[model samples]
Target: MDLNDLFMSCKKGDVNRVKQLVEQKEVELNVRDRWDSTPLYYACLCGHTNVVRYLLKSGARCEANTFDGERCVYGSLTPEIRNILVKDYV
Candidate 1:
């Protein structure tokens, strides 16, 4: 599927839809938008911890050297989310 559906699902914190999209449709969890933001990035920015967790668990990347990774770490809505990015994705 397209990043639109995957990004919307993550942004809305639709965990089930995210799961279905990633699992059944094989959506790219690390797909970036026009601004170089990923599903994991939006999930972190929007405080969608569950969605972030699922994205990571499903193999979303968190490269510290990338633009989206930097934003995901800095723009994270919660400390726990930052910790997840630091402890798991990085």
Candidate 2:
């Protein structure tokens, strides 16, 4: 898949597809899209805690801040989502 497709999948929180693509090495985990976003960033933005954990375990950077300067965690999370993530992934 192309970079945009990969980014779209990441934005959609397609954890299985993300893992498959990454494992196949067909997609670069750290590749930045037009908006300068990594797969992990999109996953976090969409509140995919499971995806976040998986990506983090796979070496996706947790501290990649957004264009507006919010850390990946803070940029993507609401209070409820953050709590869930803290409980599950942190």
Candidate 3:
């Protein structure tokens, strides 16, 4: 599968697709795109709560930073997503 496929799936909140890519195809959960955005970053940016949860549970890293050195949790994340990442940090 294309590496961008995971990011696209998370951006669209397609949890099943994300799962298939990660579980079946063995895609790296923390793979970053050209912009240095991970699937978790996309999931949070798009407000896909379920996708975010699944990514986290699947060992996605909350501590990942964008190319600009900004934390994914500090990006366009919803409060719920911020909470999830914050809780994981602590």
Candidate 4:
């Protein structure tokens, strides 16, 4: 029901709020917005790596492809962001 709230949190890059809502309220992580983009996709499209990491930590599915046929990585990330993501893996 509060899909828009999820989307807006993604847009604003509010990682803490997003986490709280998703954890407490059980909001749908994969809900597509009017633009047909899930929160993970939008976070990637916006290049918000911290937000992306938070979402990923919360089990947001990155495989939810958006209009560009790219994972969140391909659309908004550069080598710099790649380093951040990779750091977490290491």
TM-score of each: 0.89, 0.73, 0.84, 0.72
| lDDT, candidate 2, 1-90, per-residue tens | 678767777778788887888888888677787777777777777877777777768876543233422456576665654654445444
Candidate 1 — what's its lDDT? 0.85
Q: Write the per-residue lDDT of candidate 1 for residues 42-89, one digit (tens) a residue.
A: 899899999999888888888777776788899999999999888866
RMSD of each: 1.4, 3.6, 2.6, 3.8
CA deviation > 4 Å runs, candidate 3: 64-70
Ranking the candidates on TM-score from highest down gives 1, 3, 2, 4
What's the residue-level lDDT of 19 in candidate 3? 90
Q: What C-alpha lDDT, on a 0 to 100 scale, does residue 8 get in candidate 1?
A: 87
**lDDT tens readout by residue for model 4, 35-78:** 77788767776777788888777766644344433555566655
Q: Write the per-residue lDDT of candidate 3 for residues 10-87, one digit (tens) a residue.
A: 999999999998889569988878887788888888999999889889988765354422466776468987887767
lDDT of candidate model 2 versus the reference: 0.69
Off by over 4 Å in 2: 64-70, 78-90
Worst 10 residues of 4 by lDDT: 62-71
Which is superior by TM-score, 1 or 2? Answer: 1
Off by over 4 Å in 4: 64-69, 82-90
TM-score of model 4 (CA atoms): 0.72
Question: Whose TM-score is higher: candidate 3's or candidate 4's?
Answer: 3
